[model samples]
Target chain A: MLYLGYCRHCGAGLLGLRRCGQGHLLVLCDECDALWQTSDLGQPPQFPPQPDLPCPHCGQSLNGPTAHWASLDEVRQAGWNDALIVGPGGCSAASAT
Target chain B: MRPGRRSVGLTLLGFGVLLAWLVVKPMLPTGPVETGQVRPETPNAGPPASVERPDGAAEQAERPVERPIDSAAGALTELPGDVWRSPGGLLYGPGSREGHRLRHVLRHARDDPDRPGEHGVFDGDQAAIVALIDEAYARSEQGAGRVERDGPRSVVTVDLQRRVGYVGGQVGRRQGHPATRHVRLVLEGRNVITAYPLRP
Candidate 1:
């Protein structure tokens, strides 16, 4: 899977960034469906976190056990190789240069 | 004038009149002409207008002419199979990273890492999975599913309420993952990010 990081709470969950219709950048967990809002791409969660958005997969409350942001560096430290970049057109492979 | 000369003159006059009529006949409007109706400059310029054919049948001018499905050589005129092609070449050939994304999603068709025993698995082959994704995308385009934005990508989630595949993942194998009635597909833009069975 092309992932940005692994969920800190649930070690098995794969974490990726998703944008909501209102232009909110949300950190999402594929395994647990947890969610966290962030103001910037690949950055930590914003302070005074926004209200929890519904999980896109299950349509349930996104505030699960692993509802926190994990930066790219932390993801690399965790040994998840081939991490994708959060760009204007969603996740993409880093340029060779 | 002499009689013969007079007869020749009358005959000449008759021929002249016939020639005049031939030239003027085309200039004169034939049949009932509609005063305000203007002919379209282009074939598809306006709405369909009913026009009488030489066989006296009224046909819509806007209707496109139908063509035969087979060629004169008895070969199919169109290519076989679905017209849509995977932009990343996952299904066709010359594979790319998109294939990896597809495989990751298909993994759930066999096993759910989080809730291994509880979730079901998809039953069909890669083609079936791709077809389901295509259908979900169609429905999503028609506003049948939930649509969200992930960066510049569009994330569409569609729930197909039918038995798409049987349970056969790592955990479901012990229980003999039976046919599931509902399936959910998560698509990023036109690519299917992931798809798996959901408990009904």
Candidate 2:
């Protein structure tokens, strides 16, 4: 039940601010070496929009094509599709069903 | 001569005595019990109300209470399966029967939010995946049981116990038996979800 604010990529609790190559302060995760640059310090870094983005350290794909890597984006996409559909089982089921 | 007031008064007095005898008859003892006619013993009554309940029954009655769904969290809680809310505020469970049919899209839907309707795919979070699975399990259970949210694995697991009926083979032609069923569901907030029935 404890929410310790884990890093989404590596499940690590250590998130520190470091300067990226672009001279912007980026959030760095020590466990996976994932970095996120946010425009505002108060706001959380957005989910990476790039597909198949890899981890800087582990070389593992950060945002894969699958839902595992793209969960946040997937949910947001679902919201829009939900509105266009005439009913519940449309959207993804249209292709697979 | 016609009956006088004294005769009427005397008749009334006799009726009163008979009524009194009827009322007192049940409480009064008979002459004596017959030697051959023994009284039957009464069944022992249960213990008094103040007595403590048996530990097994007490524990069984004290199972954890299921919490209501959070309606504001989009379509995650709205799925049709059994739902478990982890202490970390993660909602998870298995997919419902109908939901299971949607596994094709559930497993392969791309996470392209920028393109939106072009992919004909819907984006989802771990909670959404959990909700889809949860909806599938709603028919099997009243609610999710033994929920776990593993941060390291980034997964949610729920264990459930159920009673299922089975038909016997040649020997069971005449009868059916019920067996206790146990199932475990594992979800990594993605398409890597799986469920297996356990030996009870």
- The top-ranked prediction according to TM-score is 1
Model 2 over residues A26-88: C-alpha lDDT tens digits? 344322233454313245433321223344434344322110211222323433231211111
TM-score of 1: 0.34
* Interface DockQ of candidate 2: 0.02
List TM-scores for all candidates, in order: 0.34, 0.19
Query: What residue pairs are clashing in model 1?
Result: B110-B169, B123-B165, B123-B166
What DockQ results do all the predictions give, each relative to the true complex? 0.01, 0.02
Give residue B157's error in model 2 in angstroms. 4.6
